[model samples]
Target: MEGQVVMGLQKLRVMIGSTTAIGLRALARLPHGTRLIGLAASYPVIERWLRALLCVYQPFPDIETATKYIRRFIPAGHEHSDVVSQLKQFADVTRESDYPVLFYLSGYAPGLSRVFDLGGGIGNLFYPYDRELRLPATLRWMVHDLPDKEEIVLQFAQSRHENRIGFSRRMEDASGVDLFIVSGALHYFEDELAVILARLAELPRLVVVNRTPFSRADPIVTTQVGDGYVHACKLHSLAATIAGMEAVGYRLVARWPVHERASRVPLRPDLNDTYWGLFFVLEADRRRRDASL
Candidate 1:
């Protein structure tokens, strides 16, 4: 009788939690609703409910099973293939046609003798350009990515026998780089991006960010499921991103829409479906003016 009563109480708690979650999810679709949902559906409440429901049938001695199950709902970082496939797709497109990056590069190439490609996967930008056109013999390109991706990028570079391309896991490797190119990757850094941007002792002459999703609405961080993995991505505010750059003595030089693709933030589809690109140049005059102040 005692065991049955405990089981009944567990079921009741699960039912209540499930209903709350469902309603919160629905509320998330309405304007100005996400904040409310974020508050009500706190991680603990959701985790507790998931645990009770998932463990009731077959209990596991190890906690790993539960952690794995819960993480499916949350965003973890991604592995090589998750990023490689998307980069390869972009590379293939670049090979066949003139893309915006190439257009921008043409205008700046004379001045850009060195480049740091942040979050560059398997040298996607370098490989295609190297094969299609002759890069400046004096140009040096470095790719910075997660540690796990270094080996794969090295192999890809070796396959092409491209000596100009180098790989590193450290951001310090980007020091003194003439150009900083962050393509299709900044959103992953989200709030952390500001910290990284601020840490640069000597800013690059130019910074180009491409395929970044932005919105007029408030910034949001959400989980994105891609290539069978869950990753955290942020949809930033265009104004805010520009402000951030300006804060660091960079001026917005150009802006455009990707047009090729859009990213929808699940519940707020209307707000963040479109992606944008931007270019910023260091304002030496402005920096000197600020220093004088």
Candidate 2:
């Protein structure tokens, strides 16, 4: 009897999913159907169907695929070649040039700081900053990633004998961190982004999100294929993302486009392909600290 009930539930889920998908595709053909469907349909239902559609068209054998592709595709010992290239370009800019990120950090975290780099991928962001800038003496950079990735970072840090850098496989180790840097990583944790944000008890004073894809229309989940591996990525809603941050006592201070990469939704070609970077600060805490300073 229990088995029968489980099978019935599964069947119902599939039926609802298929009907929702068909309705959405049908609505896409009409003149103003996209807007109408967005208003009428639930976001979760639509997102589920979008994932299903992507799987049918662009199947990924594994969702949690490793980043060993970086080694295979990118040159060895240059895992962060992309970031390094960007930094090299920035180096040509005059000292008077207004780089918002550098300016913001100078004003907000002028002194010694501790940074928790979530999904940092072998400390790519930190490597550039450490090599390029004269940071405070007491700076500590902690990178949180998968265990295998952590080992990779550890090896990299050891090779350089970097005392200021550390690695962790757990998010809880980020406690008391001053800055939380999340670059090109939120999409991979689409389902858990909200939960992870909400659970951060020791909220950082600053949060930096770079190369995150967002859509004004609706949230989309699609498979990204490259280097013979497939991984799921989500293009989330801009408004929804802002709201989630606001719920956690953070406010957007600045935002800019990441023009290096352009990506379109596989199912919905109408949406823009541009990605963006966002800087957020804990509003009340920042204001109080500023006043004190």
Candidate 3:
């Protein structure tokens, strides 16, 4: 009788939790319901318990602040060998989100020589893209990532006899590149896109930021607890990102939804957002116009 009662209570709790989650999500969709939910979520004790229960953690004002908190649990979550090894499995694979990037690259392939891949992992895109696109013989694809990833990428490149792909530790090396790409890693940095670009001496004509999370609301830093890893991710406003690019003399040429990735920062339905794929091109005329203004 006691065992049966315990099992019955467990099932009841599961059912109640599922029903509540579904109800909350449905409520978030209704008029002003999201605002009401947000107000309730803002209570300090409730927020702490909700975050703990959901495993999604707190809402931070910036990436630096979030990072400090996350480091207490895990030291350099992404730099682990197991994580890099697991990511290597996708080196030759292409997803639906990759098609948009390939489409843009097809147009610029003939003259594309230098590509600075910010936070690119061990030439994941390079291997797959080379098979599909007519890549230039003089291509120098630089993967900028953690120091440990360099040797791994170098060995991987050598294994395939790919002399075109290399590794760089310096962001300054991104200057004068033919193409600048930041796929799925832009949110890891504290700086805004425009702020980073401003530091570059000569901005690349083409920029592609893919599979990055962006919010319609103001930016907030959140903790992403993955298998054996934890990362501090900042979801910036989509409009702010576009405006920042325009401010840096780049125009939005294309934008697409990365439906595979989404962020639901627990309790904060207002902060939930899907990932985005964006393409930008530098315009000298726009630069001149902005300067004149």
Candidate 4:
């Protein structure tokens, strides 16, 4: 498929370059399953990821609270870094939390996960997220991924959260749902980009973009989405993207660096470098439609 090929080419470069984010725009009129070959572009180094990683590695954000989110970290891949383990622990928590009733909304990532990951990926980072913060049995969760990535997410979603997933009718009106999560969604889109936001704008109390960036403090964190075969590609800045998110209803609620300690097999102790982790949660004020309305 064109999508697969494009992504493969992109990955090939990331294996050698600085940043990577999956994306491909499709027209509303395009027929289902139509493949669009993404001509490859030249790879470029964007040190944003590198700098962020180093900063967190040195003077890391306070991880005590992220510990409350012990459900995000898990079988942290590569070096079993604190961040990876914490994420895994976090996912494990989500698997057990009572915050169910998924407001399964979605959109494309702006090729950068600043505020959060908008759509799920087969990228399989959940393994680490689960190890960092284990999914809580006390919460009900909704997994958001693209249709192409659904079957896999569904398989995982069912194995963990089971049946409690959806924007339960009147849930927004129930004063407020415990938590509205975007978990691993929010990297494949741009500003004002969706039918999903308009809906989420009218529902859910809290939105946690578990996997995106938030760097308003700087303005140089941009990366080129290079094609494997093309000579060049456009560069996208992470700072600009977060600004767009604020423009919409989403406001920055909380942000912290994800970190974890070194470990054993349950943890991958071979981490090569510290990951530059950032997470942001957005809130939406929905209308309260009564049963009689």
Top-TM-score candidate index: 3
What lDDT tens digits, residue by residue, belong to model 3 across residues 105-219?
Answer: 7888888989999989887878778888868889999999878889988998998898999999999998868899999889888778877877777778889999999887888
lDDT of 4 by residue, 100-125 (tens): 21212222111112222234343233
| lDDT (Cα, tens digit) per residue for candidate 2, span 196-243 | 655655667788877777776677665444332334666777777877
Best-matching candidate per lDDT: 3
CA RMSD of each candidate after superposition:
8.3, 10.2, 6.3, 17.5
lDDT of 4 at 55: 22
- For candidate 2, the per-residue lDDT at 220 reads 65
User: Which stretches of candidate 1 lie above 4 Å from their native place?
Assistant: 1-77, 80-90, 95-98, 131-133, 192-194, 286-293
Residue range 110-175, candidate 1, lDDT tens digits:
656788989887778886665555577777888888777788777777876767878877787666
TM-score of each: 0.69, 0.65, 0.84, 0.35
**Which of 2 and 3 is ahead in TM-score?**
3
Query: Clash pairs of candidate 2?
Result: none
RMSD of candidate 3 to true structure, Å:
6.3
Number of backbone clashes in candidate 4: 107
Candidate 1: C-alpha RMSD after superposition: 8.3
